[model samples]
Target: MSALTIYKREVSSYFAQPTAYAIIVIFLLIVMSLTFTFGGFIPAGDASLASQFFAWHPWVFMFLAPAVGMKLWTDEQRNGTLELLGTFPLSTRSAIIGKFLAAATVWFAALLLTFPIVITVNYLGDPDNGTIISGYLGSFLVCCTFLAITMLVSACTRDQVVCLIVSVAVCFVMVVGGFDPVTTVLSRSVSEGLAEAATAAFVWDHFSTLTRGLFRLQDLIWFGSIIVVCLLGTSAILSAKRS
Candidate 1:
């Protein structure tokens, strides 16, 4: 079987169940609610999504992305289907990438649904289109990053709840580690070089950079490196289990 075959199967299975729909609804509710209420979308008087809209993406993805990905490998393992899947003609890497892409497609659809917000901003004010697009790109990358982390965690366990909890915890650290308040507190005690290194390794700086409409090569490298490392780790764990 090709990766495309596995991708189509996983995507079909996701939409066949209510899991994908529920997550998309919850994500929309939380993000839109926060955007208007706490995020001060209107009150901020900011034309760009950087401050009031995209700012909340990392926090939202820190939980929901893992929730969406928790079942990727955990369900197969729990239902004793992992071994059966391994017997397929496809490589373990193909299965991993297919499932990951399927999860990403669900989130991509959810993000696309938020286009009305784009229309609203455009109608209300002349926001920079390039910046808005960059913010959306950054938000999607944030979700993918969490999903990749969850894939690795899900491969290590059979229980979906355990996968969810561990994945969220790992994502939380990455988000919090780059937060200004947390960094400020730590920077006071730690050396500046160490604090800078920690921030660079985490998600906030790179994500914020993109949200600001600045697509740096290093930002792409950071997100890509973490994602590639996690997916490879998932492959290794599954391979060991299959053997």
Candidate 2:
């Protein structure tokens, strides 16, 4: 009935299956390969993990976050557990928060597993550990946002494939909405003030700023608002369905 009960169950469910481990392994391997091979982390010869390493996180997260979250509710529904869980004496809001915390934990663990990269950077030279920490925090927020979006979509569907595709599509738009061309097009069609505001609304704007080690309240608010809104929407969706 308590949020803690649901949180513990949700998190335990992840380890109860091999799927979570597979996702973590795939994420570490691909991210490391890109960091060393394509990202030119070493050849760049820079102490910062900025553009060379964390730069690829949005793309990496676009796929993997959905993989982790696509089943959050879709599987519950498919297995007839959604309704059963609803009758467990907890509010839908508790379920939403518990699920989000659970997903975020998996993501944070996956991020932690990439510490060898951190070790490499430290070994090579004295990099700004503060900046590195901020970058990881920003990436964690990104994962949470994506998971929130995925959870919302999963709440809307019982088919995991549909949930995955919709979540990916939404996440993709959020990522690309910050690109130069997209911003340019919006600026041309909309009033300059509105266009600028719209472009700033994209994930890339705030996320990139944090990656650069600049901690602004505005950036934190942007991600915080998205996380809260999406998770709330998820709760609403489940509540409506239950009623």
Candidate 3:
């Protein structure tokens, strides 16, 4: 009936299933391994873990966030509970916000678990804590954006698998929109302004700004705008179902 109640229920549901546990474990393993092995945080002469850690977040969230968010509305629709939920005193906007916050909480917990890496970096060398802090902020914002997109996609379908696939595709494009491969291909046939615009559309652009320990207002606004728009779209879809 209240936002807190909805938040608690959604968070509880995530932990109740094995999927959430599996995702968290896999996420940590992949991120840690990549950071040390490939990112060369251990052997590349840089004592700071920020490079290895933040570098993997965008890729990790591309898949893991969708895994967490795919069931938000799809499962309710599949099990015929969405209709009941719409009848509650809670507005659609509140329900969407509550669910988004719940999913974001899970992501925050996942990010917090990586603090040992942060501690390890501090133990090894005089790493910039400011950069590490900014990295966490960037990572969380990226996850929120991904989750919002997945939530909107989940609302569009009763099949969670379909939702997951569609969300992944959409998130992937957003992640690579700034990559050289993507931008290069676009540049060959498009105007420079158009190519730049394409590259600017990805989360990677805004995330890079934060990862540099520079808290740019525009980057925060961009990520926040995406979250708001996607969640608002999700609420609209659910409201249509209710009507």
TM-score each candidate.
Answer: 0.98, 0.94, 0.95
Give each model's whole-structure lDDT: 0.92, 0.89, 0.87
lDDT of 3 by residue, 1-243 (tens): 588889999999888978778888899999999998889887776654557779788998999999999999998899998878777787888888889999999998888888788888888888888887898899999999999999999999999899999999999988888777778888897877877897678888789778878898989999999999999899888878767
Ranking by lDDT: 1, 2, 3
State the lDDT of candidate 1 residue by residue for 1-243, as single tens digits.
578887898899989999899999999999999999999999888889898889999999999999899999999999988878888787889999999999999999999999988999999999999999999998999899999999999999999999999999999999999888877877899778777887898999999999999999999888889999999999999988867
lDDT of 2 by residue, 1-243 (tens): 588888898889998998789999999988989988989988899877988888888888999999999999999999998878877787888888888899889999999999988898899999999999999998999899999999999999999999999999999988888866778888888767766875688788788888899999998998999989998898888878877
User: Can you give the lDDT of residue 195 in candidate 3?
Assistant: 77
Candidate 2 worst ten-residue window by lDDT: 190-199
Candidate No. with top lDDT: 1
> Which residue pairs overlap in candidate 2's backbone?
none
Q: CA lDDT of 172 in candidate 2?
A: 92
